[model samples]
Target: MNHTLAWRLVSGVKINHLCTPRIAIPSKAVTGSQQVREFSTSYKRSTVMPAWVIDKYGSNEVLRLNNNTEFPIIHYPNEVIVKINATSLNPIDVNMRNGYGSASLNMSRDPLNVKTTGCEFPLVLGRDLSGVVMECGLNVRYFKPGDQVWGAVPPWKQGTLAEFVVASGNEISMKPKSLSHTEAASLPYVTLTAWAALVNSCRLNKQKCPGKRILIIGASGGVGTAAIQLLKAWGGHVTAVCSEDAFSLIKDIGADEVIDYKAEKLEEQLKSKQPFDVILDNVGGTTEKLALQFLKPWSGATYVTLVTPFLYNNDRLGIADGMMRTGVTLSSKVVKHLCKGVHYRWGFFSPSGQSLDEIGLLVENGQIRPVIDEIFPFSEVPKAFSKVEKGHARGKTVIRVTESSK
Candidate 1:
């Protein structure tokens, strides 16, 4: 396995509060027809907009703020154009900036290989955004012009590090009225990732979560923090593993127990919390091997890890051979762990507006909150990338993309 790739993928995959007034959307009295009429008359479509883009992937130095990046358009009737207000950085953003996951992402960008090589140049890198609907495609029904929204853009699409972005209607939902654009921007990517791992892969939800014990490895980062609040809201017993310095933050977010991964007897510490119903591994490498040992045997216990070699394998080998290798490796691990009476599964970031809709309810009800570590101006995107690249982040690194986001 490529250790660097594995670590970077896991670390990069992994929030805050703001006092600014909520940006409200138009009332329901302004129906979709009215919204359409208003948009058609007032919205002057632009051919280009300011954006932070990369002509080539390498490091922070490669990022260029271009004032003439082509404006994104709605190709499908289900798509809508959003004027971005705020955005946030994930580990994936940092890794993508450094050329990680290029092979698979490039394939996704042009599945038929119709586009020439290097066509993905001048690409955008942000994954999460909180913005307002500027224009909607004809078939869009649930949202309209002036609606506020938040969602995670899939890695294959152009990202949110721009003045405006285009996303599918199914990829976004109503933003929480309680949080500012900056705070709302911090949750989507990481929260959706955590939701996929726990609720999708592990099959834990509010109904299934109560009385269940869940363990989160690398529990102070973006995904870890989100996972803690989610589990707690569902009444699960959450044990968070992170550096000792992050213990307070972990506890403040409702972690039932906190274990310092750097403790002298790390394995012993984990053993004491044995028989966990689900183990969410955010830090890959040796932690992947060590974590499975704590799951309960033969009780539908599962070990779901977000750090898989799927993208790495594809990047190193071509898609065909890489997928075959990844399948064989995952099958072997699953079978081996099944023999030990536990199930092993690889968790991935799944884009789900439905999940965000439910999570938005949670936020409005005060069951979940954004955990932001730092915020940078749009001009300092490179600096934000550098901060995430250094790691040890308490929560998330955010970017205020528009002045009005303040």
Candidate 2:
């Protein structure tokens, strides 16, 4: 295992490093009788939990299964504790493991720094989770114990790779009864990203979707797959761009038209179609700008990228006077011309319960299908991640964390 150091800022989390001998789980970080009860339960339980933990940051080889105490049951009034049944590996997880992506690197290096500097080492990785609610915080009213739930959580407080994780109750939604935990786990990050990009960031109105044309780059990715279906649901005509190998898969996922990005020139192929009303660009690089050339003038377009702005030269200036002046001027101009009346939304998907509810409804109704590529046993997280890092994964890759009966 190639262990390397990284840093992260954990809100209220003081440990620079967590080691064995089970550090006395803080009794009560907050004062209150309810708080004491909430925290006491975590230590009261005697079951040792299994987790794929990373002693240091690196690749899949660094992931090691360890028996650790159950996560502290302590919850803020707004928090919820989940007994994770299944979890999905996003590109963010892999990027975090390799200590590569801007988000991952920043999160690890500055656990207390919210400004995204770099990520920390020994970060247990996993983003989207589908599980059962084992405990609810004192102030949590949205959820109750025994509720089947699924959703994303703040990347910093990662215990999902283990038997339990604590998250804001508002970040969870009732898991759709129609799908299994594994299937639901696969949807959170992708669906949340799609929801934020298309609905929140892109401002895609359902009423405006009828007969409108939209282009989705990297249409076979997790977010791309979700985008194609959501756009189609809104009654928009979707033009999907993907490698030749994934062409049929994209088409099956409801893309009205498919572009073989490898075979033909993107702009040239899209020229005949003229300006599209909106474009969702998952792949940055020249592909993003080239797709912009096909956007219709004054037609209300938006370009959304999962990749961070700094990586894509988004020109974000810090609070400093010098950076403010220069960054603001350039950023405004770039957004203006990116598309004719087009909005540029550089997005980082937030965990939300409401969004997950919407996605669950869509899946329960069969408006969207869970595209599962592979399922790995709990011990095979490394193999699952290796497949994801290769970038050839067909759809979502799932890891079974625990059996339901347990």
Candidate 3:
């Protein structure tokens, strides 16, 4: 199995968990009127969760399935253990498989860089997950055992690829009731990217959002689809760029204008539209450069891209030179774009339970909907990662982690 074993998060998860034990099943978390016993770590973690892990980074060839993988545990206050129901795949997971961030992985070993460190082998990798909370730390307040939740974990830690993963309370929220675990698992990573790019970087929050015009490139992918829905929720005019086949789904999600990337010259379409307040780009390099023509100049229009740190150089040049060169190259681009009154920044996903709560509200109110491309059984994870690596998925690809029905 690989990236798509129905995947899922860590920190103020408000969850981390291990193998499942058959216990008295409660439909929901223990609340005010319900009488339930709290979980203790000493309780048998007799079950071993299976996981797909890598001892050393490489391509898909390095992944090994270990059915006896130790169940995850919680040693920190504010932590909760989660039994992952499903997870999804993204480009980052594929890159990590090929050792794309080996330098950062090595550097994280320094004690001073605690925030940047990832787990040591046998390391599991999956960014986001939706699951049930099995146990809550002694100091944890917001959630309790039996709570259904979802969140994204930092890439530097052991991932949600196993039967369980630990997360802090601040990193997760109760999963939206409208979404099944498979549907909820498709969120997190891409939705967080959309939030970072649009809300955090472009300043499209509630107060400043009416009537703003935004353009989303690669609008058919997961991030693009999420960006479109979020932009609509903020009352912005959305123009989506995708293939003709994707137009229906894009339009259904509330895009004001949908441009077929294949049928039209994108630059020509932008020129006709005049200017946009923000351009949230999923494709980078040349496509990103060309799209600069449409920014609403003098208004300090922002251009945010989900691609950054330009890994191509890392592969061509060695690590140190590649890093130095990336810094110089990025600085040049930032300066050039800044002078034209456009702010350019890279988008990175940061998990926030607060943000998840807001998104859940949106989901409950029917403001946004999850877009799933395909679902692979847990055992077929390598095929799922390959699909993401090929970069042709229509929306998000999900994995079914357990054989049981939701």
TM-score of each: 0.89, 0.81, 0.85
Between prediction 1 and prediction 3, which has the larger lDDT?
1
Task: Give the residue spans of candidate 2 off by over 4 A.
Answer: 1-40, 43-47, 101-121, 311-340
What is the Cα-based lDDT of residue 29 in candidate 3?
90
Residue-pair clashes, model 3: 30
- Per residue, candidate 3 scores C-alpha lDDT tens digits across 126-151 of 98889998777767778877889989
lDDT of each: 0.86, 0.71, 0.80
Which regions of candidate 1 are displaced past 4 Å?
Answer: 1-45
Instruction: For residue 308, give model 3's deviation from the true position in Å.
Output: 1.1
Candidate that scores best on lDDT: 1
The true-versus-predicted C-alpha distance at residue 145 of model 2, in Å, is: 1.1
lDDT tens string, model 1, 16-72? Answer: 111121122344675543321111111233667899999998978899999988878
Show model 3 residue runs off by greater than 4 Å: 1-47, 109-119, 310-326
Model number with the top TM-score: 1
